[model samples]
Target: MPEDPGLPAGWQADSVDGDAPAEVERLTELLRAHERAARGWASGSEEDVLVEVHGLETRENVVVRDDTGTIRAWGSVHDRAEGRMLYVHIVDRTLADDVATRCSDVLFAWAEAQARQVGAERGLEVQQIDTGAFADDERQHAWLERAGFTCVRTWWQMSRSVEPEEVELVAYPEAWSRDGVEFRLVRREAGGLPDEADLRAVHEVLEGAFTDHFNSAEETFQEFIHRLREDPGHRWDHWWLALVDGEPAGALVGTVSESSQGPDGSYVSYLGVLDTARGRGVAKGLLHTIIADAAARGRDRVGLEVDADSPTGADGLYTAMGWGTKYVTESWHREVPVS
Candidate 1:
């Protein structure tokens, strides 16, 4: 690798390899520290850190140091789906904004070069930089805008505290019911992995549910499976599937996040009801089941992210169920022609 021309004096960059123990430890520490300062999430231990670093499709960790050899800033870029899209996570600066910006420029330049290299190897035509910024994070929003990105969509981070007080379950209209509709928690047949048939059904339901949504990328069944498997918090038993007359109609996937740094922090990672199943009790049933499970687990709160402008008005459903917006985040995209 050649030296980055954008790097300011005394700052240096290093590439991290998951196979290298020392590199993993250093990057993990940097990420964990950043999490503590930026978000209330707890930092993962070295072992847990390896899970993320090793699972990424393509990864590059850049560390910036000062003249005194003290670490100043760190950033990582990961490639997903054979190099067509890249996700930037855990970018943090130990120094001030001016110094951080210069370091970030160097890091991004390297990322662009790596993207080009990966694209060439995979025969891809375009490279995408994907990231999300919290609505309250003015600094990050400004940085992203200045870097030529635009906010394209908004997500509401919502949470609801589970209290023992009198609570009533929301019911769907009788006319919304589909014949033979049923709901069940994903169970382990023999081993701990999810049932293949059930998993496929869930994926199908999700695809159908979000078809009309903005920027709904079609995901292959294998890709969906791989994604869940990649998450450190993923637990198969936490998943629920709604069926209409014994066929999958919708699904909700839940996970426990120690990252929340709270006594109650379980999250509903994915929730969807197929188009054919919409307006039925499937969505309500799934939410009820998931919330019950979370409460049973002694979780303090349950949370999920929803598109604020969803055509289906999903955010309203969540709010009606007692969820309140904790924060907002925006997704920005710049589509590049595949050709």
Candidate 2:
């Protein structure tokens, strides 16, 4: 057993500033290689790394380097919500088993420390550290399990190709009404920013919609807006709110996807319909709005992730809407008591 949880003997660990072009390139390459090994494709990019590590206020990152000054592993923790801390773990597959295991220990320890700090700051009794892995990646599964994390859920990463003609086929009126339900983009103010009231409505609708969902936690308005704005692809117009009989009932938040291997796309970052608005076509209407918006923007596809064991049977709806699962991912979580 290693005496130090942070690093093994002869290894050096340091906080990453998320600057230094060479360091960023190396990290991006490491991410790409890992993704390719796990899923047969690479989607990691320099921009993604920057976004993940740059927001030091709400995130912390560390890098493990060998004696040769080569980075062998990377870890990041995001204070995702009041009681949840999101973790990112990446290790070089080329390293020896013992070395890789030690790297995992270091990253896991760092994440646990960050989680506890967040919990203490929020005055919580416990904090959940949430991490994810490719479903088919046995290495990640072993690492997570060995670190006392449990596989909590599986998600289907689904995608649907967009046809240009869909812009004409799908009606995307600014404020359309059907069956007493209205769908429209969140209103903008005179300064070109989204209306505060509309934004709050979207947040409240999502919060209410996910109240009964698995692993749901309370996220403050400030945290919600700050985290979403951190994404490089975030756009004001991609946010849509649904009103059922003039009451906020649902919301859909979409983001642009910049792909290096193919044309850019659109991703449904979030879609939530309040329980009171279920079965009213609110969800379907929101989906159509984003699809039409993607088509108008010439995006090749629209992608979204659905919980495999969702009580709402959302996967079925996505499948029926022409979306197909392209890959699968699993969530792993470990809870630590705040000290």
Best by TM-score: 2
Cα lDDT for residue 222, candidate 1: 81
lDDT of each: 0.68, 0.89
lDDT of 1 by residue, 158-235 (tens): 998875321223232111233456667665667666678888888888888887777666778886777677777788
Per-residue lDDT for 257 in model 1?
Answer: 70
Question: For model 2, how many clashes?
Answer: 0
Model 1 ranges with Cα > 4 A deviation: 1-4, 17-51, 56-60, 67-71, 81-86, 89-92, 117-123, 164-180, 259-264, 336-339
* Weakest ten-residue segment in model 2 by summed lDDT: 1-10
Please give the distance, in angstroms, between residue 205's alpha carbon in candidate 1 and its true position after superposition.
1.5
Candidate 2 regions exceeding 4 Å error are 1-9
- Please, what's the RMSD in Å of model 2? 1.7
Per model, state how many residue pairs clash: 3, 0
